[model samples]
Target: MQQLRTPHVVVVMGVAGTGKTTIGPLLAARLGVPYAEGDDFHPQANIDKMSAGVPLDDADRWPWLDAIGAWAHGRAGLGGVVSSSALKRSYRDRLRAAAPGVVFVHLTGDRALIEDRMSHRQGHFMPTALLDSQFATLQPLQPDEAGVAVDVTGSPEEITARAVQALDALSRPAK
Candidate 1:
C-alpha cells in the first residue's frame, strides 16, 4: 500500500461517533505518515463546553479548526492525516483555504449505532447528548469538494481498508 502522507494532506472527518480516531491512525500507518488528532488542538474552553453538553458555536471552532488546518498546511509537502469533526461547510471551506490540496474522508453511520458508540466511549470531550446538535449541523461534502464519503458501520479494519483504497484512488501526486 502507498503511504498516507505521500499526498499533501488527508482529513478524516465525520460526526462524533464515527471511527475517525481509529481510522486516522491506521491510514497514517498505511501511508507511513504522521497522524494528528484534531481534537487535541481544541482549547480547554471548547473541551469544557463540549463536556458540559453545550455545542460549540462557529466562533468557538474557528480558531481550533484554523490551528489544525495550519498544521496540515505546514506539512503539505510531507503529508499527514488529521482527524476532525468538520461538520459545517464553512469550516471545511476554511480548511480548504488553509490547506489547498487536503483531501477529506467522510465517515457516516446509523444514528443509533453512533449514539451507542458515543455512549460507550470514554475520555472524549464531546458528550453523547451533544451528538444530535452535531448531526443537525453537519453538511456532507459537496460534489465539488475533493472527498470520499464512506459508511462507518463496518469493522475498523474494513473501514480503514475502504478509506485507504478510496484515498489512494482520489489522491493527487505529492508536490
Candidate 2:
C-alpha cells in the first residue's frame, strides 16, 4: 500500500448500488482508517422516502450531506473512509466545505449492471426505481475536483485496489 504524506478523509461516492458500502470498509482497512456508513447518517424521513421509491429533493438531502460532512470534518487529519451518494456537484461542494482535505472516490459503471446489482441486493432501502433519478442527479467528478473516478466493472477487491492506486497517485507530489 502506498503511504499518504498527509492522511485524508476519503468519501466513496456514487449512485445507489455502486458498491460504496462494500468498498468503503475495505478501503478504510487498507488505509488503516475508520469507516463510516453514509446511510447511517440519513434521517428516517429520507429513508422512508427512498424506500417508497420517491426521489429526494435537494431540501431533503441538505441535512444528510451536513451529517456526513461533519463526520468527515471530525476525521480530517486522522484519515477515514465514508460512503455517500453525493450525486450532485453542489452536494460534493457542501462536503468539501466541511472537510477541505476530503478526497472522493467516485464509482462509475454501466446503468444496466448497476440495476442488476440493485435487483439482487437485499434489504437496501434504495429501490431500483430511483436509479434513473440518481443518474440524472449525478455530476461526475470534474477535472478540477480533488478526486478519482474508478470503474466498477470488477469485483470488490479489484475496484478497491483501483481506488487505492488512484488515491496514491493523487497523494504523490509532482516530480
User: What's each prediction's TM-score?
Assistant: 0.93, 0.96
Per-residue lDDT tens digits for candidate 1, residues 1-175, read 2223356688999999898998999989987889999989999999998888899999999999999999988989888999988999899999989988788899999999999998898887788888889899999988778888888877898998898888777665655
What lDDT is obtained when candidate 2 is compared to the true structure? 0.93
lDDT of 2 by residue, 58-171 (tens): 999999999999999999889999999999889999999999888889999999999999999989899999999999999998877888999999899999999999998988
Global fold similarity of model 2 (TM-score): 0.96
Task: Please name the candidate that would achieve the greatest TM-score relative to the true structure.
Answer: 2
Ten contiguous residues minimizing lDDT sum, candidate 2: 1-10
Clashes of each: 2, 0
- lDDT (C-alpha) at residue 67 in model 1: 99
